[model samples]
Target chain A: MRELIAIEYAKLKKFHALKIIFAVYMLTVPGWMYFMNFFFQMEPGMKALFTSDNPFDFPHIWSYITYSASFFNVLLAVIIVVVTTNDFQYKTMRQNIIDGMSKQKVILSKFILVFFLSTIATLYTGLVGLVIGLIESTSYDWYQNIHLIVLYFIQTLGYFSFAFLFAIIVKRPAIAIVSFILYFPVETIIGKIMNADAYQVFPLKVFADLTPIPFFKSIVVSMKDQGGKTPWILDTNIQIILSLIYVLLFFLLSYYLLKKKDL
Target chain B: MQQEIVLEVKNLVKNFKKVQAVKSINLNLHKGEVLGLLGPNGSGKTTTLAMLLGILHPTSGSFSWFNNGTKDENRKRIGSLLETPNFYPYLNAYDNLKVVGIIKNVANLQERIDSVLELVDLKERGKRPFRTYSLGMKQRLAVASALLSDPEVLVLDEPTNGLDPQGIAEMRQLIIDIAKEGKTIILASHILAEVQVICSHIVILREGEMVYNGSMNSLLNQEQAFRLSATNMEQLEQALHAISGISITERTETDLLVTCSEKIDGSSINKRLVEQGIYLSELHAYQKNLETIFLEKLTQ
Candidate 1:
């Protein structure tokens, strides 16, 4: 397992696509945070902008940072798809297998790399959020906020894992990215057209549910005015459990296909 | 026989939908021997190699390596280059080798990587991305990767497929050196001359079946020997028919070739022709080259 991890790390380092995605993340996250902090001040009337008890508080800074960095997470998911699928596209998987590594180990390495990268992004977001929040206001509840920030990191991982599974199953970066793009809007339109409460149980809905804010309430006024009356399909615990199931199921399916594949 | 054999495939079979790529093929390689696997396109050479390396599963039958262990564990003692070298295009040779080293679980990986690069004569270009490499360079790197682990067995499929004449010669020498170092090699190629020059034994496959397998010398020895040329072609033919132990197998404008069942010197044939009053122009011993033998087998 250790050797497999080392191999995957070397592969991730050698892959330009991963490096470019990471570079973009590093540059854009800090740049966007600083831009928001120094250049664009939030107007007093903007309710969406958290002012008092802002989730983007110090020591809990990652919470706000991750919220703002979600876009980049989506991009990272696409990159993961590309990295995994290229092995198939270029027929390198056959070479790798012949070189001595097992199919299980190869798929595990990809999962490990994705998990590690998502963790880093989540922590980076959290830390930046805390620092920027402290700079904004020092009197915030740094201790309680730090706890929430940790929860946010976990939630981010859960969501990222779900996206990673999609990438794995689809095995094409472009298709995965397009599917990710259409995910939320399609879920929204379908949920409205069907007016089915059960639609909220979808994977995307589970992801939205894990966020600090509720999904339906944020989108529709009727759902919001109901004031928690809408069905709470899954709390954080259920979301985490389902996300893990998604990871296991997709990883197993991917492994089976890879093992049996003709290359 | 068991002690000398390095690899054995028994009744191995593989199919792709309606096409049978390998049909009940069996092969064996001995230590310090280069076995040339000769076949045309889609003749199952590559497929056989793939199955040997555990990249492609056989539809039936079984193959074992070293005769004692599982395929994956035994694979550690074997190295193969079945097709084009595939690497992270963005990475330099050194980094690409580093990744392979890690996956292969080699000790002293850096030193191993350096040594392999040197062995393939790609040390100077080791730091360049694979995308920048020429075709021959890529092949050398592939060879280097196969050599990295210093396995006892090396399997290569068309190792010099796209190389220039000079590159092919260099590769041929390299393969020879590897074989001399006591490594068992299975080299698959369509170039009969290359195989004839480097391989001690040969296996010829046609339409997913083994058409021939034996030593190079034995395969050549099986061909008939006797060439006849005469000034009077009609008299030469009549005299050749009257002679015992000599049977005409081929006829051309300039010569009539016969296969002699027993060893007979050119002088004896000349005496017999002279006694028959048939003037002989040329009489020489016939020896079949690898190309001729291969063409004969293919046609057969």
Candidate 2:
């Protein structure tokens, strides 16, 4: 296990795009949150409207930050797609196997990298949530609703797992990236044509709903009292379980593709 | 004493949909034997090696290393470079080798990496990224990586495919030096001369089939043809024809060319001519080189 991590680190430690994309992501996650905080404070009418919502409040701050940061998981997914497809593009996976890495280890190396990246992303999200909440909230319990950070990690794994699948299937960085990027909008369209309840159980829907829009559910609940037909999403715990299942499914499919692959 | 069989391939086969890439290739590579795999273009030489290295799934067959099945740990004992120099283009030679060292689980990998870099003469340029390397440098880095583990058997496919004349010579010498360590090596190449110079045994493939497999000496050990001159050429020609195993192929004013079976040598023919009261002034033994034999094998 140490050897696999060391090998992956040696391979990507100098990757410029990995560094740049991650830097951009790290900066934007907290930077965007701070920008929004200032934007809301400067607008009087908007402040009056959102005064009741208070996205940056202590307990609610966890949801606000996680929901906002979940979108940037695409950047992490792009990193996964680029790094995984790089093995195919340069044919290094074939070389590594020839050099004595088993097919299982090759897939496991990617999993290690995914786990590492998710941990980094989660910690940053948690730290940003803590600092932002401490600054904005007047009084609160420290660990109130902090489980969202853990769910956010699961969501990150779900996104990266699908990215790995696309890379393994497509075998080209550009095509894999484009396919992964297009999947969300495309699934949304497909879900629209299909039954609303069926789409709720879809992988993207489940992962996305893990950290659902912070105050929007309450707004929808109020709207539902007035006979609004907004589609109902699964509970957070169910979504987490489904996301874990999808993560496992994607990893297994990736392994199957590699085990049967000629490369 | 018989050497241990290091790698045993039992009728390994591979098929790509409608096209069969390899067809039941069976051979035993004993320890310390330098085996050369020779073939023309599209002859499945690379495919056979890839299967042994687990890069390709053999359609229906098996192979063993060191009298054991090919397990994950056993793979670390074999070093292979197939078809091309594959590395991360953005990584330097040292970093590229570090990945291989970790995969091979070599002890004291830093020192091993340095030693291999020195062996390939890339120690000076080890820090340059692979993308900035010349073809020969990239190829040398590949050799270094393959040697990083100092495996029991080394498998190389066309190690000098795109090298210059000097680079080719250097690469050939490198392979020869490694073989001198009494290590088992399986080299696949199109250069027959290269094989003739380095390989102790040879295997020729054509259209995914094994056409010829034998020791280099057995294949090239014959006295194919000879030129002889005698004081009385007429008498020498008659006496040569009298020998049961040889035939006079060419007759000229000054000499006669005799094509003979492997049993016939210059002394036997000389004795026959002298017995018939003819004295020979000149006798030259001419042997057929590998290219002609290889072509003949392919055509056959």
Candidate 3:
């Protein structure tokens, strides 16, 4: 098992796409924080700008980071796609099999690497949120923040797991990236204009709803302020359950595709 | 033969989609023998080797190594190099071999790596990255990887491809030396001369079918006729025609080529010619080489 992990680590380290995505994430996270604080003045306690009592509130941080870096997550997903597709493209998996690695081990290695990268990205974003929250407010209970951190990590895994499945099925990086990018707007537009309740079950909706943000509370606030009808049918518990189901289904599907593949 | 069988393939068959790459290949290798898998491109040489190594799943057949079943335990006793040498380009030769050692579960891996590198004559270049090495060096490193576990049987597919003439000769000698140490080797190659020089047994595949499988010398001796040259012109032909055992093929102004039905040597032919009052300046006998036999089998 230790040797297997070492081999997977070596493979991930050698992948160029993973390296570039990591560099991009490192640069973008700090840069985005600086821009929001200095130029846009979106920092808390600014009278002219919108401010919350605790911008580090789970929902607030989720919305800020997810909205700010959602495009970057898409880019990271593209990197994952490229990394996953290369084993098939270059026939390196065949060589790995010849070298005595089992099919299950090969697929598990890639999956573990994907989870590792997602965990790293999640922790980075959470750290950035913690730093910005500290600058905005000096006093807060760090112990209570564990739940938010756990939720954020789980959400990140959800997105990356879906991307992993996409990559495994398509076996082509460009197609997977395009499909994931187009997924968001397609679901949003269909949800609002067509009044489709089925969008609630879509993976993107589940990810957004489970992202530690009280989206329903925000919607209710907006509705009360504007004198409009309340939106949404199911509660948060159902959404979380659905997301977990999606995660389970996607993982099994990915495993099935990998096991049946000729490579 | 019971104690000698090191590797056995019984009616092996492999198909890719609608095309059958290997068709009912039956082969048996003895200990301390080099079996040459001779065929042209796309004749399923590599495919057969892959199946024997268990890297490929045969459509219908069974093969065993040293009477052990086709499992990881059996695979541990066999080492193979199918297709090209594939390793991490960024890693040095030593590191690459170390990785292979770990995969093959070798104990005292560092010492084994050192020994393999020295065996392949790459001890000095072991620290250099594999990408920086020449094609011949890379192939040698691959050989070193295959030899790391001191496997009982080594299956190499075109091990000398891209190698220079000197490298080819060195590799041939190395294989022969390894076989002398009681290791069975199955070499797949298209180089007829190398096969003839190194292989004790030959298996010829043509269009996914085994056309010939036997001892190399016996295969060569299977040819019915031999070419004979003589200095006497028509007298040699007239003398040869009179004898029912000899058949004259070509009669030139200065030479007469004849074929004998039985296995006859130069001295017997010369004695017969002299007894018939047909004096000859020179008498040369011809035997079939591997190239001719391969071509004949392939064409048939």
The best candidate in terms of lDDT: 2
lDDT digits (tens) for residues B181-212 of candidate 1: 87888889877777888888899888899999
Model 3 C-alpha lDDT per residue in residues B193-233, reported as the tens digit of each score: 88888889999999899999999989988744545555556
Candidate 3 ranges with C-alpha deviation above 4 Å: A12-17, A39-59, A66-71, A75-79, A166-195, A212-216, A224-255, B4-6, B54-56, B65-76, B121-128, B232-287
How well is each residue in B207-265 modelled by candidate 2, as lDDT tens digits?
89998888998888644788899888877777777779898766789988778887878
lDDT, candidate 3, at B166: 90
Candidate 2 lDDT over A1-263, as tens digits, reads: 99899999999999999999999999999998998789888875675554376778888889889999999999999999999999999999999998888889999999999999999999999999998888888857749989999999999999989889999999999999998999999999999999898999899889999898777677677778999786577987789889999999999999999999999
DockQ score for candidate 1: 0.59
- By TM-score rank, best first, the candidates go 2, 1, 3
Per-residue lDDT for A99-139 in model 3, tens only? 56666666677667667777887888877777776666455
Task: Estimate the overall C-alpha local distance difference test score of candidate 1.
Answer: 0.74
Show pairs that collide, candidate 3.
none
Please give, as one word, the docking class of candidate 1: medium
Better of 2 and 3 by TM-score: 2
After superposition, which runs of candidate 2 have C-alpha atoms over 4 Å from their true positions?
A42-51, B228-259, B263-282
TM-score of each: 0.88, 0.92, 0.83
| A109-135 per-residue lDDT for model 1 (tens digits) | 877876787678767766666666767
Worst 10 contiguous positions by lDDT, candidate 3 chain A: A47-56
Predicted complex 2: CAPRI docking category: medium
